[model samples]
Target: MIDLQTKLVGLIGKPLEHSLSPWMHNETYTRLGLNMAYLPIEVLENDLETVINGIRKMNFIGFNVTIPHKISIIPYLDDIDPLAKQIGSVNTITCCNGFLKGYNTDGEGFVSYLETSQGINCSDKVFLIMGSGGASRAIAMTLAARKAKKIYLFNRTIEKAKQLASEIMSYYDCICQAKNLDDTTLKALIKKADVLINTTSVGLYPNIDQTPVKYDLLSSHLIVADIIYNPLHTRLLQEAKEKGCGIVTGEGMFVNQGAKAFAIWTKQPAPYSMMKRVLEEKLI
Candidate 1:
């Protein structure tokens, strides 16, 4: 029953072909009897500003940001949440009275997934995060804020990882280190890590065969997590399982994040169970 009164929400990013956000959000809306709809809008980097300007003039409640646009979209928004500003990325945006605000739900969402679903506490754990992108920044900052004992950031570009680590060290009382993606460093750091998270798009859909870390680096004591939910079982998770490592799929973070974003937009508790079921069904 979509009409002029329906509140529209969207996911804005490129290569949204594999996104499960629309299904998850719309199912929750249907179950809750909300007059809302979620759509996926594929927009390239060059057209982000133009698309955002168009959204402002429409009846949109809010939208989710992803991938290449997360960091770049900051300037276009009217305001930014403190956490998102600090993390240097924006994954969620809200619109009210024609004013758009940005937020980074990725970190909080991932932490919620780890704490609630996996029973992992950040206070005493050592984390090895791969990548320095939007998702990576959010997760690292969140973990640091949670009093994680140590965080090691690894990325293709050492400087980016170093910058993130420096920020975490300056703001939080945590041991943060940054390193270039090398076999020697990975071998050493992974031995000391309790959790290894992949925030990179290496194992995303269409390139499902690629992985960020070598299979041999995984161990029984490590909990490997990936943020790429499209494939459900990425090659990194697959190999981690084979090596007797505990694997946390991207679905938990995806659902938890969507739940948070839903609450932000609707000003009500999200239907987590329904959203999780819908996302799991789509992935299956």
Candidate 2:
């Protein structure tokens, strides 16, 4: 346990006190008898470059990116996965031969969770995604790639939403619409959406009382999802469940994404079930 040969992997971003990634990954490593340890490092915006440089010289297998750092970390990477490049976000990174390559597992993770756990396919679903950040870019692009019928993006800044929608429409055969967070527009779009996802940090830990969408808007037919797992059931998911809507929490995505990153780092199939169990045990 105190050996110097233990390899390291971790998550790098600000406000990491709420992250369960270390628990999920470390448990998987323990069960598999892998000499690996996971850590969480909170890096400020200005110190991101310094931290990345330090990680490059250290004994790091790789690390996961989150929140504000996902997009910003791209410039520091040696290479990027084609899909992650297209999505303009990087959530996972693998270091090999002193070279750091970035990849975005968020979209694939969300898609996997949606199909297996929620029993929903992207092809026939119309999605309304809240927030236009890195996570939004990854999820929207992935859904469009899967041939989602239509996608609506709502964000505080209309331009970012439009930019992401335009990027999706340019590369994928999907009808992607973007708009400002207007009540009337949200109401009309929610009525047509089959799945509603919250990719914002509004309902994350410490700010547990905040929510991105109005509670009254959730309908019984919609499958509502939030990507904030710390609370398990966020205000959005709680309201959606109370309104009789189907619900998907952030845990599925978190576990799925971490599993993918694990495989990338170890060159072995990740123990997905065990990873999921670890996160659920802590979160649920």
Candidate 3:
């Protein structure tokens, strides 16, 4: 049912061949009877300028950004949401009359998922986040915005973790500090934190057995979350649940993020259930 009249939206990043966004977004459009096509346009770092220029010339509604472009896309955008500005990254973009507006929905998506899927609230909760990459940045920024009481951030590289913690401390009133993953102090903090989030790719496909922390170290009092959805249930999550800890999978964040993007582009309610099903089907 697609034609020249179909509105165009897509993703821009190198190595986009591995992205499942097109499948999830296209299925949503088709299921909703909307004439829109979401494509995965791989644009290398050197070609970002050209691709952005082309987006302005075309009839594109909006698109998503990934990897290297998230922060780099800032100057090119006509406007930016405050959340995106604070996170120092942009993932969703809206085009209006050739004007591009940048947004970072990753944090919103993650927060919304925790709230609706697990009855978790950011305020007054202590978070123990593993990793200091883009995913962790978004989640940490969002939690800070939501007024989380404290966050004990951990990373293999202490400097990277400290940098992120410094940013949070500079901007928010929350008690955020960096700690070493192998440190006895961080391990003690984890046992008492309200939530434990694994934002690293250690538990991803091929490394299915790898986890940020040992399973026996997990506490039943903590709500564990891993932001790797490929296997649906990572080893950390399996171990957490087995020890009677509540767990949140990466699937909720993945689906909710796209749902936010869909809402942004269409200005309508996304079929949340179907979007979840589409990705679940792909994983299976």
lDDT of 3 at 4: 85
Tens digit of per-residue lDDT, candidate 2, span 1-284: 83789898999998887677888888889888999999899999999999999999888989999877998999999999999999998999998756999999999998889889887778999999999988889999999989999999999998999999999999999999997898888988899999999998898887898889888777899999998887889999999999999999988898899999999999999898899887778865
**Candidate scoring better on lDDT of 1 and 2:** 1
User: Where in model 3 is the C-alpha error above 4 Å?
Assistant: none
**In terms of TM-score, which candidate is stronger, 1 or 2?**
1
Q: Model 3 over residues 96-153: C-alpha lDDT tens digits? A: 8899999888988988898777787789789999999888999999999889989988
**Model 2: residues >4 Å from true position, as ranges?**
none
lDDT by residue for model 1 (168-284), tens: 998888999998899998999998999999999998978998999988778889999998887989999999999998889988898989999999998888888888998888778
Among all windows of ten consecutive residues in candidate 2, which has the lowest summed lDDT? 275-284
Residue 188 displacement (Å), model 1: 1.7
How close to the true structure is residue 91 of candidate 1, measured as C-alpha lDDT?
A: 85
lDDT of 2: 0.90
Question: Which order, best to worst by lDDT?
Answer: 1, 2, 3
- Candidate models: Cα lDDT each: 0.91, 0.90, 0.90
Candidate 1: clashing pairs of residues: none
Question: Could you tally the backbone clashes for each prediction?
Answer: 0, 0, 0
Best by lDDT: 1
Worst 10 residues of 3 by lDDT: 183-192
Tell me the lDDT of model 3 at 54: 93
